[model samples]
Target: MGKKLWYHSSCLLLFCILCTNSFAQVKPADFKYVDHILGYWRMPTKHSTFTELWVKKDDHTWEGKTHRITGRDSVEMDNMQLVRSGNELVFTIAAVADPKSGKPVPFKVTVLQSNGFVAENPACDYPQKIVYKWKKEDELDVHFKGVKEKTFSEIILEYKRK
Candidate 1:
């Protein structure tokens, strides 16, 4: 009985720490200036490259396009929308692989950072989490990871401003 109680107590403590440190909500002042995410970013690998374009549409809306580049051609791989509603940021993505992308799914931002944010769809089939990290003014790192096929995996992409 003592061993089980200890284990449960430890798990609860860890959960509290993770919840406090990993998630953030945008305040009015912070969401007021998300234009930093607007622009172009490219990630190049030996085999292929990924590119993203973010455009500000207004005070509360943005559009993003992601492409896969090999050789010289760029193929659109994902279309996304970033919207700020009140104090929350919403992400809607249309991925080429999702047949139901005709009606995109909305993922709300759960972790808001100084320069980037993470949005998630816990109901998704594969990559349920998406994270964008700004390493520098000209560098962005993106992570796509979650439980897929009952296995946890992550894909990291490093991007530089173009």
Candidate 2:
């Protein structure tokens, strides 16, 4: 009788632990702050302009496209998607010039806030982290950071709402 009671207690404890872990997993509604990034943004250089347009696809997904324009020529740089997967918010990218035969890369979002989010993919060669922050209502700042040539390096791109 003692062993049976102990076994039942242990089973109940394990069930509670599993329930708590499942409840702790991330969900689509938790990323509602991501809606702030929807719209068009542009960064202009002396010779070219880089633009990103984000659109909400559904309650759990957002799609973004990036393009570079110089003179009368426009070229797509990449396609990006922010999606709520089973237990994570993933940032997936497929770049036109990707060296890995254009295979899409997936980065799991680690931080989420009202103004920004950080996504990381440690397996990527160059940029292992991508951070997006809103500086103001009209300004957006994006940082790409990783190890390059055995040294830590970062690239920042500032965009204005267009």
Candidate 3:
């Protein structure tokens, strides 16, 4: 019974791994609008505010940096990037401050619709899916969804163009 259970558990784990990596795909051309994601976005409050900047680097990539300010202090948040990779575009997160030195974990952009695009990194713990949606009418809507402690977790951040 013990051996049978162990074998079943191993198979289940392998299946999970395969499924996670086999998401959908999108064309590189569909990602062209990501350039509009550049410029600064901010959410303001009375005491503090959060701001993010996406700076373009050539035609294929944009460097991202975020700031959270409370009173007199401003804190730097995650540094990220969006880049074109072959037939698709990818989003990568920096593991440290010095981007050149840090190894980036890449999330493949799989779905690009009229509204926006979706990217996923199967191996990541906090954000398995990262989605960015924009319409000419207004703000950028971003969603981060993943699993946590055997449960699904999601966070949404809306940013207005500045």
Candidate 4:
């Protein structure tokens, strides 16, 4: 009777171990937003209104090219990596320094959409924080608080598929 009990207990233990192992082997797939986020998105910043072109490069990352098209193609920025962060997406904007000699400084970013169109991150100032909302017609609205008055801006750009 003792031997039978030991054999059954060992079998149950083995079964439990196998089940746990298989569950651990399962991995989650990366989130994909190329269809929803690709193309051009225009939003105003404190300095200028700019347009951003987002292109999907792979399953785990995307590329962004931003430019001040209102000027003579003057200002431009590019970033190649962006990863999903919890229920949102996070990316970094490289600081203006040579990567070979200087350490990389990132302008931390978080992306989300709400109430028409919105994107925000914790790095934004408290209260008014970083926010983007689409305005009436074609323009997109942006707000960032300052010491006194709340700075408001607008972005006028048309988004189209490549």
Candidate 5:
């Protein structure tokens, strides 16, 4: 009787442990993935350098600043916004701000996020696309399509943790 009771107690303890281990824990929405993308990313190619500022806003929206820097010339800004649509991520550029004018002009572009981060530019007659690939080392690989071959350089844009 003593041996049977001990065995029954061990089985009960094992059952409890198995049940706890099988239960899946829920992850919070504002977790690691979203946090990683929220910062300044510097993209450097053989030809030029560019920096993008990703600012998180209310309602899962992001304000972005795309700036191109060349030689001694000042930064040229492209103002844009990003919002998640369904399972895909969507980006809309409000305008391409000219340094000379210092004004925001009408401009728009949309990109569908794929397995890798892809931007689809369908507004123009020719389709322009941008793909952002992540490396194992935590660097972002950027590729531009429908543009000049040599002109489109490979850049590793890395995010700085805040």
Candidate 6:
């Protein structure tokens, strides 16, 4: 009787684990909407040119990096990832010199559309909200908003496909 009980408990545990893992995995169809963002995007400023390169790592994950180029020097500013976590998509960013030991900060994607999406992380110190909009086939607009110096601030970046 004890042996049977132990076996049932083990089986239940295994079933629970399997269910959790299955639910956590992202489906490939859910990731297809973000496919259009894969490519090289460039935004030139007066002092430097900012570039973002995005590539798909797998059906469930996309990786990206931002770089600032001034003269002959190119410096990586941040690393980004778009991944499916369960039924939802998460956008993560890790600055090269982040104050929190460069840990990746996660922003939950709240709005997803054919042309763009919005991700928000209210707990983040800066850029609590991130917005991406496609202006045209070759143009993209990105906006970051948060509080800085005790005042609300927002920065907009316009990029062209390169």
Task: Give per-model TM-scores.
Answer: 0.77, 0.77, 0.74, 0.40, 0.47, 0.76
Model 3 ranges with Cα > 4 A deviation: 1-23, 45-47, 95-102
Clashes of each: 0, 0, 0, 0, 0, 0
Predicted candidate 1, C-alpha RMSD? 4.5
lDDT of 3 by residue, 74-103 (tens): 999778898886777888866422345557
Which segments of candidate 4 are over 4 A away from where they belong? 1-35, 42-49, 70-74, 78-81, 85-88, 95-162
What is the C-alpha local distance difference test score of each model?
0.82, 0.86, 0.79, 0.47, 0.53, 0.84
State how far residue 17 of model 5 sits from its true place (Å): 47
List where candidate 2 sits over 4 angstroms from the true fold. Answer: 1-29, 96-102
Candidate 2 local lDDT, 48-80, one digit each (tens): 999999999997799999999999999999899
RMSD of each: 4.5, 6.3, 6.2, 12.1, 14.8, 9.5
lDDT of 1 at 135: 88
Task: Give the lDDT of residue 69 in candidate 6.
Answer: 98
lDDT of 5 by residue, 1-162 (tens): 999999999999999988764432212332224434556777666777777777888555677787887887747577666565444345555453345665433222232222134556534222255555555334555554554443543333553222
| Alpha carbon lDDT at 76, candidate 2 | 95
Local error of candidate 2 at residue 4 (angstroms)? 34
List the candidate numbers ranked by lDDT, top first: 2, 6, 1, 3, 5, 4
Q: What is the lDDT of residue 134 in candidate 2?
A: 95
Model 2 worst lDDT window (10 residues) = 95-104
lDDT per residue, candidate 1, 1-162, as tens digits?
999999999999999998875555556666644577789989888988988999989888999999999998879998888898887888877761455545776777877767788888788776788888888999988888899899999989899999
Clashing pairs in 6: none
Report the alpha-carbon TM-score of model 5 versus the true structure.
Answer: 0.47
lDDT at 67, model 6 = 98
